[model samples]
Target: MSLRKIKRPQGDFWFDFEAFAEDEDGFWLRGPVGTPWRAPHATGSSEVPVVVLLAPGRPWAAWWVGDPADRRLEIDVCRPPERDGNGWQYVDLELDPVLHETEGRVEIEDWDEYDESVRNGWMTADDAKLARVVAEGCAQLLHQRSEPWLDRGWKMLPDS
Candidate 1:
């Protein structure tokens, strides 16, 4: 899915590079592309679905759904025949549900926001489900650390 506006009932909202609200300190947080807050975190060569979850006591989690951005902007995940699996290439996946263990339960902070967005027609039902899938997948990955998502660190793609 291409980048679209992300809204939440509280806290800062995502306007896809446009400033939706003033910065917390009333200083500039946006850039020529979009919010700098999300710039460093962007990991893809083309437009791809992603979910980032920030935990109070745990590390912030990132599900680079499909392709991992690394140092390059490999955001464009293509169809099966064109995909090369150089990155996490789950082309059919969308919605990124971010999950982490919290007091023995998995939690995702944005479900409410997604629900609200879907109800208000700002977001589609499929996208919301995509995000939820990410969360579920993340929980298993975090617990087992057995697959590709196990790597918590990022390596910049050469020439990105």
Candidate 2:
């Protein structure tokens, strides 16, 4: 199946992945290295295996990248994903909490873009507030390494 991410004021990104597993929380998707992905401006294949967790009612999606040098974990603050056909789709809230394992730190990224979206009315005030809350909470979880999905996703990674 494919996961589609709709970015406010801009593009749509989609990637095909195996529906590897599912539980009470939500679905788990696995994309092997070389899996193709497309965005409005560009297209490419993943350089490493990836696992993503999309939990319904949670305002974020968690991703685990297999490469150690890369940002190992990234949480995209967004609206809860909705099932679409055989896939899922959500509108990105723009803020993201990324864990760079090599650096041993978590960074909140894309704040500028998020601010722009809010200012331009690409997102409503309530949506912007929700995004901020989710982003901050996710960042704290990333910093403390306390999110269960993070560990679950790590373990699910191939050869983790």
Candidate 3:
């Protein structure tokens, strides 16, 4: 009889979120998506992310060009049920208008309560919402430009 071959899985090793959580201070650094945000340090930092103001329990994520080397950010988010409401859904935002007047960075301040049905669909739940704000913060803080990264990969993946 001929010998049979076994198939192995591909790609990187499994990521341990629990371990990651134990190491970090907050669950999220850049802040959560959909919820209103305020920039406590927007005018400062020159061209780097200083800080983001997020309601307690929400996640925070941001992006910036780090030391010209391998760089990545670990992110975490609160589930929908855990949140207070649906103010962060994809159909209730106006990103273009928000970033239009800014030089390159987009600073979010005065996060008044918002209804999910009104906000535009610029971002989603899966895309580490904090990262989007961080990216915009970097663009504005440094170059006064902003480009949202919503629905980017969704077009490629099959719908659930």
Candidate 4:
């Protein structure tokens, strides 16, 4: 997988995206093609990953080396991703679990929204736990400078 530095309100960091593809063994394979991420097996065997964003120590947030061991984020929701007018999608209102990095720790940008989701039955307890696991896992994976942070298994829709 390839990574590029991006500047956004969430924070500045290296980012990349991946698509899932069934491998020869039928298990899903992810990542670009070549290099460390060129080939990575899916951990959960999920056929299609929702959407994700990850960043390293925080060059976007200011180069703060983070502890990959830390996992204390309260995942609030994992609603359907909001898509833009052009069809590009991103986490946004009604379906967003904000992530942030501070002093080497991954933090949730909003617990209120997450709580509200639970209060309104917008997100279930089980789904909340799944979201938490995904966020925490991302926190750990993004701590390193390796290509793992930019992984995307090369599962993109063809431009026909």
Candidate 5:
């Protein structure tokens, strides 16, 4: 499957992944090392395998890095994914919750981008509000390690 991240007032990014698995809540996408990805300013391939969960109505997409010694989870706050051609697309809300499992750290990244989007009216007020709520919730889930997607992603990791 293909995943497109649409960032308002910015260039969109796309990734090609395989459909690894699916359940009631969402489907898992697996991208192997060297999977090519393209962004606005740059293009590169993944250095490690990745597992991503894209739920239909969830406000965030969870990404699991497959580096065993440096495994981490990253969640992007977005406007829920929707079908776009043969893949899916979602508007990125800017805020992201990143969990560094090895360090037991959770940080909300890209606050400046979020703020700029809101101040410049790049995103709607309601969307910004929803982004904030989802970011906070995702951070808390990362801290508690309570989200099933977290574990599910780990299980799907390469060589897990």
Candidate 6:
């Protein structure tokens, strides 16, 4: 089987088409492409689903959801509660639980020291059940593909 390739701003991250969020309702809105903050995070609650990309400790973007029936899922993108100036600050992402339940919180320290690079201190809480389902689906897509690494410039070696 041939590996299917999709073009993303940051070069091309390998992902199965079927598993990737391709629906028009789904989109990735974050910092510039190739940036660490460049992942499609949360979905919206409005008639149109919005895909948000949050900064490490700053609230940079928001994707609006226009429809309640729309399914919004946020991936791993949360920081730690941190100090801003006079008090501590944290990032909170909330969605309509009845229609979509994708809530994420990130702790932060001082606004200046706030950075996504520090991984240990931060925690990303996603729907365990939903994560499992998405993981399984991705695995199945990989199984169906043949040369999944072709896009990565991998070739068969001969001799020895």
Top lDDT hit:
5
What's the CA RMSD for each of the models?
14.6, 1.6, 18.6, 14.6, 1.7, 19.3
Estimated TM-score for each candidate:
0.35, 0.92, 0.18, 0.33, 0.93, 0.19
Report the lDDT tens digits of candidate 1 across residue range 75-149. 111111111222111222223333232323333345555566668765456655645565565555555546442
lDDT of 2 by residue, 12-104 (tens): 999998898998768999998888999989999988888999978888998888885674788889999888897989999999999987787
lDDT string, candidate 5, 1-160, tens digits: 7899999888799998888788975988899898889999999998889988898888889898977777889899999998778888999999999998788999999999999999999999999999999999989989998756678787787653
Give the better candidate number (3 or 5) by TM-score. Answer: 5
Give the residue spans of candidate 5 off by over 4 A: 67-70
List candidate 3 stretches off by more than 4 Å: 1-24, 28-56, 63-104, 107-160
List, in order, the clash count of every candidate structure: 20, 0, 28, 7, 0, 17
TM-score of candidate 6 to 2 decimals = 0.19
Candidate 6 local lDDT, 91-149, one digit each (tens): 32211112132332222122222222123333233422332343344334333434333
Residue 83 miss distance in model 3 (angstroms): 11
All candidates' lDDT scores? 0.31, 0.88, 0.24, 0.32, 0.89, 0.26
lDDT of 6: 0.26
Q: Rank the candidates by lDDT, best first.
A: 5, 2, 4, 1, 6, 3
> Global lDDT for candidate 4?
0.32
Estimate, for each residue in 57-156, the C-alpha lDDT of model 4 and write its tens digit. Answer: 2111111112243312222223333323322222322222223333434444555655675677666677566556555554555455254323322123
The stretch of ten residues in a row with the least summed lDDT in candidate 1 is 72-81
Which is superior by lDDT, 3 or 6? 6
Off by more than 4 A, model 1: 1-106, 152-160
Instruction: Give me candidate 5's TM-score against the actual structure.
Output: 0.93
